[model samples]
Target: MTQAPDKLVQSPVVPHIVTELPGPKARAHLEFDKLWTSPSVPRAYPVVPVRGEGCTIEDIDGNLFLDFNAGIAVTSTGHCNPKVVAAIQDQAGKLIHYSADFYIPLYAEMCAELSRIAPMKEKCRAFLGNSGTEAVEGAIKLARFATKRQNIVAFLGAFHGRTYGSVSLTASKAKYHAGFGPLLPGIYHAPFGHVADLKWFDEVLFKHLVPADEVAAIIVEPIQGEGGYLVPEDGFLQGLRKICDDNGILLISDEVQAGAGRTGKMWSIQNWDVEPDIIATAKGIASGMPLGAFIARESLMTKWGPGAHGTTYGGNPLACAAAIETIKQLEGGLMANATARGNQLMTGLREIQKKHPGLVKDVRGIGLMIGVEFDSHEHAAAVEWASFQRGVLALEAGMTVVRISPPLVITEAEAATGLRLFGEAVAEVAAKG
Candidate 1:
């Protein structure tokens, strides 16, 4: 039998189910969705969630789900956390929006807070934006402006974002590129995390596409999100740093998914003891509010003057307020809990894989950003459906991997409980196959 630890706080309200998932109300609403939106728009396992608090979400049917995905690892403070809610509410009353051209208090506070926790505080500066894509866009622009080079190198099976510039660096799937003709010129793709890939960067990169003279930057995720949670081999980070230094190329670590305390550290790159010249962050930065930013060294950032980049809601007051509270909560015990819970979850997942070798091919990740890849994407999807039926909500990353990122606030026992349900889901899939 799988282990099911009682870890969740007994919500002041327990979950209730008035009907089956995607009950009449949801299906009815979806009819409107299908009519107005493109069919390709995602609606897998469709369920309209009515409410959320802590690590759980309640569907319109009233079925409560243990949210293992955490809106793809946003909501780090947990769904509608009281503190975050209060912060948003308080700020909404005072000021909801602001112009980037004008100064704002929350803006200054967030920038200061980000600079403080960021690696190499004395050398870093930040540019705020509204999403992960914008952060990557800013980082790419900075790389070019500072170095005055053309080619940017990304990795295989990587996901930057869907925006044109970010999408060029993203190589995980063909669909992201479909219908988007002729992406930005001079971007190159490299294999990430392998020694061969590293060697290629040192040797072939200069000799081949857009030589070192033309190379502006090499961007990578220290921990690849949406790429099966592939961790870099030891020495990879330092090796890349040396390569960039030798080539005079800016190293941009796209920590959009892996940063902001999700990886048991303020930045995932911290685990490797190497520094990135530019770091992009989002996802959990504002506990689900729309926000993203890139931090650059003082010297590199100074290349752009006034009005080089701008966004209407980039550093809006409401999101900044949410970010302030999110950062405050992440400090002190919350980051420690993420570290402890990650260890517990990894240990339990390994044990489950050992017992059910036919089901789980590999379990890997750093901190809460975990993935369990199956033999096929079909198999992974089956497991996902089974998990949902069993009252746990999860998501898929890449083709054949089940992403297990939960709220960082998750307790050790809570992590274990979610893993148990996942193990059972995989076992059920294996049996059916």
Candidate 2:
């Protein structure tokens, strides 16, 4: 096993804030970003990071923080992992950009790796894309083409993506669709994580709305991400698989946030032992590189012709190289580390919940993709801010859940530190409540 750098493995006194949060340099950068960047971007905290290594982030003002969010679970192998960086540098030197229309060796290599690690039993084929939204879009198209169906069913409180097609399938927030009306036709939604609700598809939805035969797919997040990291109850996934099989519908698992070793397993769906016909993945695929893909059963993917779907930068050599190395790192030992550290974090959080029963409602998750539910959004936000003040970065999800997903490479000491800091934050919020 390759050892993590000493600093990442051991930090006696981390979050050593020499200045206040958003100190002078960070404040200046934040002000500049506000002036130039789009207003749509949401700033979780005042962190203005200039550099990151492992699970640690250093702001422009030299304030250090233990990163628990991992850029919303994108940096799986850790920030700027040396091995992934080396792969990217090597590929950049050789060839950076290439048309996906033309065959790229690295593209084939990444697909092969994906197929090897695929959760499904069938031989898999992949379509590369630039982001999670693109992956979902490709899957949507593939499901329709392969099944000759026009309708799709997604679960409520599920976040697929923000693109027109993917966003149409997203039901996590009403605001995501408030203004963008006239969404793609034939898309439907059902309550998530409830096996009983699966009956709604046959009894209510299919009977009154879109017919079962016309349904192309049912897309879902194995563990809801932006909706609050909610793990489904037992039999929920199996129920979906059964429903799809009975209706000849494809099941697409959106693993954008929960896959690539974040849940200890390579794919979060593996936790349920249920295989989906298609898998849309991105966030942690390349350890922060801009890459995503939709891997489907070979029989399904083979239905598409050459001109059916394509992207210019989908399989850029640099991103592919980084993806290969990221997979290597995940396979090496990081996935196991996630299982261990996740257990540590979950246990500590449960203790905290016990101490503040009224404030904290629930603590649930698998591996690193964990969420702590508070009594209200206000409490969740307060805890989020308090954690930031103490130099531990975290994020809020859904209405009243705080998501904790640090890098897979986070060491035991770092996990303990983050737990301690987060516990303190929760305690502070509880006291105020």
Candidate 3:
């Protein structure tokens, strides 16, 4: 039987569906979406969520769902968190934007907060931006300016951003680059999380393609985000650090998805005990507000003079305030909760994988960031669609991996309930097959 834990069942706000799929209101909203929204945005299912609290989402149609996607991992602290909202409100009422070109309290406060929690050993510096892609773009420019190099190495299945510079660094989907001709030059792609890839970087790219000194940085997502949520093999981060040191290349961790307490740490790379020179962050940084930052060691940042990189509204006061509160909330308790809930969810998924070997190829994750890969992309899509019907919200990553990055505030009972519904969805899909 599909059921929630007793505690969760007693809770009034957990995955309660009132209407059928895409009810009248949702259908109307979908039509409006089709007419007004850009076609580029890929939506898996029709769920016009009107409100959200913690890990729960309520569609305009009155269907409640467990929001496992968290708006593509952007709302890490959960939607409309009161603290974050209060911060945003207070900041907005006081000061909205004076352009980040000048000093501001929220900006200063956020910078200090980020530096305090930054993974860098020495004093760190931060350049604020407005999105994950902007952070990555800023990191790219910073790398070049700091190292005086031209070429950069990025992984093959990375989803950096949609901007020209970031998209050039992105090799996740061909569609991202379709007809976007002549992307930023001097960028190279390599296999992620593979030691051979690093060796090739040394033996081939460094030796033959581009000189090591000419390479600015090797950008990577410590845990591949859009790339199947694949965790690197043990020692991968350590090896990466060594490679960067040997080559005088900076190691840039694109932690836009894996950072901000998502991977049971302030930064996912912390699990490796290796420090990256620079880390780009966003997505979950501002609890859904448009905010991002590329933090680096002070020494690296000192190489570049002022005017080398700048943004007008990079550090929007409202976003910065919310981000600061988001950090505080995560540090308070959500980080630990994420670790425990992740264990619960992973255990359940592994059990389900064992039951449906043909459907689930693998189940793996750390913290609340998880992926369940099916035999084929079609099967994975079917399962996700089925889950949506069962009042669960999920997203797909890579070709055949379903990503589950729930809000960090999710309770253990809520996690169990989501997992149970997901298991039932998979069974339903298998039965249909």
Candidate 4:
């Protein structure tokens, strides 16, 4: 395991801000971006970060803020963690990229490690990818190839990915599908976290719309990501497990946003005590390096013929090396810290909710993957902007939810500081009411 990093300092010794948010440099960059970049990409705030360390980020304009978004919860070990950076640097010196189809010691080594920590009791095989969406796309192909089936079941409000196959399974928002039409067929959607919906599918949808025998897999996010940081009630995932088992359908857990020790456990599905047949992981997998992988039971994956699914840069040695160190950090201390700080953060947010009942309607999630729901999307969005102005960074989830997923290595003091800023943001929004 990687050694524990020095506890991060929450108090910024450098003045966090001396200019308006998105001061000159950020505005200038935004203008340049508008001229060259795709307008489809959304921007929540104008803060343009040029450097980051631990939980703090310094924007191009020299504005510093505590980053709760964690690059959309991608950096598990904090920005530029010494250990991860060291590993990446060491690997880059030796090798930068080798097609994943060919043998690489690090690639095999990392896959072995994944099996060691996988939720399944059976041995697991893995495929590497460059992002969560690619991981989901891989899962789709593997599921069908193994099952000899065509249809897939997905949950409403889930965001698997934006790729064609993965996006076809995505139901988070219509905007993701507005322009892209005629998505992959043979995919079905159901209500998330609602056990009754599964029953309805088994009884009604299965009997009328799609046959159980033809369903290849049921892909779900153990904890919904872009949909909302919605943690399902106890037994919800287990029920799906049972349903899949009874029908001979594989269960694919989209751990992209909820795994890699973010949920106080190795995988959020572990919290449910049910082993999915396939597990898709990314986000915090490699401490911000573009890496993702889907692990599945050896029994199921071995059936995939040679050269059935391949990627050129999926298992770049540098990413694998960084991932090795990331896993070490997560297991060594960050996982435990996530549990402690998540509770601390959640408790504090609940208290804030108590103080602003009308504005903060709900506080829910597990470990560091938390969400605060307001009565309206406007209030939730307003709170996000307000938090930015107060020197804290967060993201909006769904229509009326605020997401709070900081790095796993976040300190108690940092949690306190961010929550305090969050409460202030809530108060400001409440004041508007």
Identify the superior model by lDDT, candidate 1 or candidate 3.
Answer: 3
- Report, for every candidate in turn, its global Cα lDDT versus the true structure: 0.83, 0.91, 0.88, 0.89
lDDT of 1 by residue, 31-137 (tens): 76677887766555786676777888876555678888888888898999898999999999999887777898888778877887878645677888999999999
lDDT by residue (tens digit), candidate 4, 1-433? 1222344333444226757876777778888888987887887888787777988887776667889999999889999999899999998999898787788899999988888889898989888888999999999899999999999999889999888999999999999999899999999898888666668677776988988999999999999989978888787899999989989999999999999999999899998899999999998999999989999999998997788998899988989998999999899989999999999999999999999888888999999999999999999999999998888999999999999999998988889889888888999889989
- Worst 10-residue lDDT window, candidate 4: 1-10
Task: Supply the global lDDT for candidate 1.
Answer: 0.83
Residue-level lDDT tens digits of model 2 in 86-119: 9999988999987788989999989999989999
Cα lDDT of model 3 by residue, 183-233, tens digit: 999999987776655677778787788888899998989999998899988
By the lDDT metric, which is better: model 2 or model 4?
A: 2
Report the C-alpha displacement of residue 125, candidate 2, in angstroms: 0.7
How close is every model to the real structure, measured as TM-score?
A: 0.94, 0.97, 0.96, 0.96
Q: Relative to the unseen true structure, what is the C-alpha lDDT of residue 183 in candidate 4, on a scale of 0 to 100? A: 99
Q: Answer with 2 or 3, whichever has the higher TM-score.
A: 2
What's the CA error at residue 165 for candidate 4, in Å?
0.5
| Candidate 3: segments with Cα more than 4 A from true spot | 1-13
